[model samples]
Target: MFYAHNFSYKTASKSLPGAPDLDEEDSLEDAVVVFFHVEAGDEDNRKGCIQKFVKNTKWLCGKFATKSVLLHSFNHLSGSKSSPEFARGVLDEAVERLERAGYTVKTTPFGYFNEFSIHVAGDSLAKVFKEF
Candidate 1:
């Protein structure tokens, strides 16, 4: 199983583990930010599961009419977590897919607890949750 907790944010920023001079900081506006969690069972059909993830992400972004996305690896959504390597790989692959489709994508630093400041739109559609 996997879960995608999504938000449509007016603005968002992530900072930690990287200095400003290193260009490791991230800031986005009018974007779909997805807190994605990959479960161990998802690896059984990795390719298919990833395909669904990408599709769901794109669908959510489209709903908000944004071509920008922020992918964050948040394993706390479930107890049975996939390995860090597996989860990181899933995030990377999703980035490639999103970019190929002409969306600007940013991913938080993997395997680390980063700080995020998100200002979400005040609407029911601004927040969505999906599990599969």
Candidate 2:
């Protein structure tokens, strides 16, 4: 995940024309763009991913007084990515948990390539990388 000084996103086009949009053009300050990549290995450990994500989010929020998160699908982190369906499941679960934790969660729709701009923070914890 990358901490952002400012972040914004826009739904350019649907990955599938009939697919529903999950987000709209919006901007946020003091937020984190969670590029949640679902690796092939994550298919078998979905629960672990949800737990780790929540734990990491708690840490980030407390450390930075962050209240907003943008969940973006980014499969480039690893050579192997989970199936699209599996990834969606994981993403849905993460959103649910994060929202329950009182975070303002915004999600880019699954199965779509979106447009976004982010000004990454320069602080020590501005960018974080974790694998589960």
Q: Quick one: best TM-score, which candidate?
A: 2
The global C-alpha lDDT for each of the candidates, from Candidate 1 onward, is: 0.72, 0.80
Please, what are the lDDT tens digits per residue for candidate 2 over residues 1-132?
888988887877666555675656777888878887888887787788788977887787777888888888886456898887788888888888889879999887666677888999898898888877
Q: Flag clash pairs in model 2.
A: none
TM-score for all models, in order of appearance: 0.79, 0.86
The TM-score, computed over Cα atoms with residue i paired to residue i, of candidate 1 is 0.79
Clashes of each: 0, 0
Off by over 4 Å in 1: 1-23
Residue range 21-79, candidate 1, lDDT tens digits:
23245577778888888999988978987898889988888777888888877775578
